[model samples]
Target: MDIAILSVSLNVHSTKRIVEEGQKAGHYVELIDHTKCSVKLGEGKPQIYLGEENVTDEFDAIIPRIGAKVTKHGAAIVKQFEMNNVFSTARSLGIMRARNKIRTLQIMARKGIPIPETLFSINPHNIGEQIELLGGPPVIIKLQEGTHGSGVILAESKKSAKSIIDTFYKMDTSILLQKYIEEANGEDIRIIVVGNKVVASMKRISDLDDFRSNVHRGAETEAIKPTAKEQFIALNATKYLGLGVAGVDIMRSKKGPVLIEVNASPGLQGIEGATGVNVAQQIIQFVEKNGHRSRK
Candidate 1:
């Protein structure tokens, strides 16, 4: 099979691993930097290009490892591939939905998936009311498109929450507020789903001084077997978002397990290393099944 890993660079650990595994699986895999890709429309058939090279029909499948910074362009490129009948691990719409916390949460809420109590608003006039909606502070504030725990904030007091939320509203930055689950204790679950099944899962423990349990935030990880409920949520979340591969993040609250977010372009490094699961290979195999069917 001819596969393309749509990413910024082959130097990224996850990107490199996928390329190696795809090659080992006897497939011709290439790294197509979506940043350099463009599309031409209204010429009868849409055409996609990589710099000077036309890539309209270059591959049978694409595994997009899109970054938060280039999500729009990357999803556009992936959309072009979809329009051209190429199989992709993530659909274009799914990429966009997963990029924003509000959008993802909306879908999850509509689908009856358990998620943290979340609220979003743009009105700065009622900052206190907004915080009150989530039952006041110790609230979780998150930038809509934050990645790797970069824009998540914990406001431990009403004053701090009001100030932070007002600042975001005044600046026109998109953010969401959620009731912090103190029981989680800075720990969360990451379940890697490929083709309707959970291939691997891990528990991420945040550093003592931090509340975010992201691997990039220097968190510790250990392989974990997700409970049946957690597995159900992860699989359904991926399906609802139209993604063949994803990382579903969950936190065990006092009530039960609630989803925090779903990542369309989930990184393979931490999950793979912690679980000793060849998640890259699972991705390749998923593509192999669906990529062939798409061709048919």
Candidate 2:
């Protein structure tokens, strides 16, 4: 089997692991950097070129390793692959939807999936009332399209929340403010959902004085199987979001486990290391299964 991966940093740990796993499974892998790739739609045909080479070549399947920031170009590259009737670990639309937190949450809520009381208002004038609607001070402000906990801001005071939200709006940044779960203690569970099951779960704990618990934000992780309810939420959230592979963030609160966000391209380092699970193998298995069907 020959596989191609579209990613920004080919040397990243996750991309490296996927390549290694595919090779271990006796598959040839090519890690293509989408940022450096060019696309052309003319001359009665469409083609994607990677550094002067027409990559319209055939392959067993594709594994998209897109980051939240490079979603546009990455999905476009994956879309070209799909047009050639190639299977992907995740669909382009799923990758785009998972990149945007606000849209994903709206879809989840509509699907009857339980999430934290969330508020998203584009009108900066409604910031005060939106905060009140979501409960009060201490709300989680998240940029609509950011990853790795880089765009999350926890506002504790009403005045501070309003000011920060206004600034974000002034800058034309899309964001959502939700009821902050104090009982969560700046910790959350990352449930890796592959296909239809939760492959592994990890408890992401924040560093001292930090509100975000992402490993990128100096968080620690440990292997822990989530409860039956947590597992249900994890699975349903993925299904609701139409994600093939994802990292579903769940916040444990007094009410119950409420979903925070669904990550389409979840990192493998922390989750795989914490659980001691060969997640890349599972992903390859899933891809091969689908590839088999496509071949049929």
Candidate 3:
């Protein structure tokens, strides 16, 4: 089978790993830089161009490693592939929804998945009320599209929370407020799901001075086996999001395990290193099964 890994660069760790694993499994794999891809419409059937080459039907499957900054255009390329009947690890709509925090949370909430108390508002006038709605300060202020904990801020007091939120709103930046789970102790769970199976999971502990537990934020990781409830939430979150591959993040709050985020293109380095799992190979096998089935 021929595979396309839709990513910005082949130098990225995840992209390299996927390519290596695909070749090891006897599949022809290549990187299609989504940033360099264009969609042509009208005239006849719609076509996608990678530079000057028409890539409308070049592969059996696509594994999107779409970056946060290029999600809009990246999803468009993936959508074009989908319309041409190509199998993708993540659907275009799912990629779009997962790129935005509020959209993912809304879908999760509606699907009865456990999540933290989250609120989103664009009204600058009701800033104070919005914070109060989440039980006041010490809340988390996060950019709707921020990744790797870049725009996630923890306000320890009502005054700071209100000030930070007001600044973001004044700048017309999209943001959301969530009830901070202090009991989590700067830790969270990342469960990697391939197809319908939970392939790997790990606990990320934050740096002593930081509250965000993302590995890119210098968090330490260790292997973990999630409980039945955690596994249920992770699996269902992936399913409802229309993802064949996902990374579901959950925090242990005083009440229970509440989901924090869902990653459509989950990184393999951290989870793979922590759990010693051949996650990249699992992804290739998943593609082998579904890609062939889709062709049939």
Candidate 4:
């Protein structure tokens, strides 16, 4: 099987690991930078190419190592693969929805998945009332599209919340105001779910005072097995998002397990290192089991 590892850099850890694992598994794997690829639509289907080189249909699957900011173009390349009958770990629609926070949270709530009680308003008229609904002060305000703890703000007071909301309103950016879970203790669980199995998990602990638990934000990680309810939340979130593999982030709230978000292209470094598990191997085996391929 020939596998195309779609990523922005072949030097990346997860990208390198998956490419090496696929090679060890006796599959022909090519690392194609999605940023350098383009899609063309024609009579029967769409075709994708890296520069002038046409991507072949013989490839078994595309493991998209897409970044959050490039969700649109990155998933566009994956969608082209779909048109040519090539498979991906995540479908285009799934990728798009997972990248959009408010949409993802709404879909999860609709599917009966527990998440932070969040409120959104496009109209500035509802800002004041929305803050009241969120129970005032120290709420979580986040941009519709941000990752790695970049665009999230902890509004510690009603004045701060008002200021942030007003700023976003002035900038014409939609934002979500969520009730902050105090007991989360600057920590959260990152569960890697492949198919019906929870492959690995890491409890990411942030710095003493920060709200974000991302490793890039000086957070530390330790391997921890999720509870039954945490497992359920992770699995159901992945299932509802129509993803074959996911990184399900959950917080241990007083109300029970609250799912924070589900990531389609989750980083493999921290989880695999903390757990000493072969996450890349698991992902490759999953693709081999599920991906569509044609005779060369």
Candidate 5:
């Protein structure tokens, strides 16, 4: 099978590993930089171009490693492939929904998946009330599209929370406020789901000085076997989001496990290293099963 890894660069660790694994599996794989791709729509079927080359029918499947900054354009390219009847690890709509925190949470909440009490409002006048709605003080304020814990903030007091939220609203930045799980102790679970199976999971402990438990934020990671309920939540979250591959983040709270986020194009470096799983190969095999089946 021929595969295309839709990413901005092949130099990225995940992208390189995927290409390596696909080769090791005896499949032809190439990196297609979605950022440099263009789409052409005419009287005939739409065509996707990489520079001057037409790529409409060049591959059997696509593994989109779309980044946060280029999600819209990247998802568009993926959507074009979907229209061409090409199999993709992630659906276009799934990428769009997963890119936004509020959208993902809304879908999760509606699907009866457990999640923290999250609220989003654009009204500057009701900033105080919005914070109070979450029961106030020590709330988790997060950017709607932030990745790797860059825009997540922990406000320890009502005064600070109000100020930070008001400032965000005034600047017209999209954010969400959630009830902070104080018992979490700066730790969270990262579960990697390939197809319908939970391939790997790990517990991420945040730095002593930081509350965000992202590996990119200097968090330490160790392998973990998720409980049956946690495993169920991770798998269902991937299914509801329409993602064949995902990294589902959950925080262990007094109310059991609450999903904090779901990543459409989950990075393989942290989870792979922590769990000692060949996640890249699992992705390749998933493609092998579904990619050929889609051709039927």
Candidate 6:
């Protein structure tokens, strides 16, 4: 099978792992920097170009490892491939949907999937009322498209919450407020799903001074088995998002496990190291099964 890993660089850890694993499985794999890709339309069929090379039907499938910074352009490249009857592990729409926290939560809420109490409003006139809507302070403020725990903030008091939210609103930044789960104790779960199966899961514990449990935030990790409910949520969340591969982040609140977010291009390093699972190989195998079929 021929496969293309749509990413910014081949040096990235996740991209390298996928490449190694794909080669080990005897599949022809190549890395295409989606940021450098361009699409030309209105000249008969759409043409996808990688610099000087035209790449319309170059592969049987694509595994998009799209970065947050270039999500819009990356998704467009994937969309072009999808239009040309090439199978992709993630749909372009799913990438866009998972790029924003508010969008993901909205879809989950509508699908009967459990998520934390989240609120988003562009109105700065009622900042206090918005905070009150989530039962007052000690809330979580997050940039809609933030990654690696960089744009997450914890406001421990009503005054601080109001000030922070107001500042973001005034700056014209997109953000969301969520009820913080103190009982979580700086810990969260990341479940990796591929092709309707839960391949690996890990518990991330934050540094003493931080509340975010992202591995990029210097958090410690350990492999763990997800609860039946957690697994159910992970699989269904991936399905609802229309992604064949994803990482579902869940937090335990007073009301059981509530989803925090779903990652369309989940990293393989932390989860593989924590669980000792060959996640990259799993992704390749998933493509083999579906990429062989006619494109839908």
TM-score of each: 0.98, 0.95, 0.98, 0.96, 0.98, 0.98
**Deviation of model 3 at 135, angstroms:** 1.2
Comparing candidate 1 with candidate 5, which one achieves the higher lDDT? 5
What tens-digit string does per-residue lDDT give for candidate 1 at 160-223?
9999989998899999999999999999999999998999999999999999999999999999
Q: Give the TM-score of candidate 1.
A: 0.98
Per-model lDDT: 0.93, 0.87, 0.93, 0.87, 0.94, 0.94
- Tens digits of per-residue lDDT for model 2, 189-241: 99999999889999999998898999987899999989998999889878776
Model 4 C-alpha lDDT per residue in residues 146-229, reported as the tens digit of each score? 888888999888888888889899999877889999999899999999887899999999988787999778899999989999
Error of 5 at 285 (Å): 0.2
* Cα error of candidate 6 at position 245, Å: 0.3
Q: On residues 1-296, what C-alpha lDDT tens digit does candidate 5 reach at each position?
A: 98999988878999999999999999989999999999999889899999999988899999999999999999999999999999999999999999999999999999999999999889888877888889978899999999999999999998899899889988989999999999999999999999999999999999999999999989999999999999999999999989999999999999899999999988899999999999999999999999963432
What are the clash counts of all predictions, listed in order? 0, 0, 0, 0, 0, 0
Better of 1 and 6 by lDDT: 6
List clashing residue pairs in candidate 6: none
Q: What lDDT is obtained when candidate 3 is compared to the true structure?
A: 0.93
TM-score of 6: 0.98
Taking the tens digit of each residue's C-alpha lDDT, what string does model 3 give over 1-296? 98999997888999999999999999889999999999999999899999999888778899999999999999999999999888999999999998899999999999999999999999988888998999887899999999999999999998898889899988999999999899999999999999999999999999999999999989999999999999999999989989999999999988889988899999999999999999999999999989853442
What lDDT is reached at residue 49 by model 6? 94
Residue-level lDDT of model 6, residues 180-225, one tens digit each, is: 9999999999999999899999999999999999999899999999
With candidate 5 superimposed using the best TM-score fit, by how many Å does residue 258's alpha carbon deviate from the native? 0.2
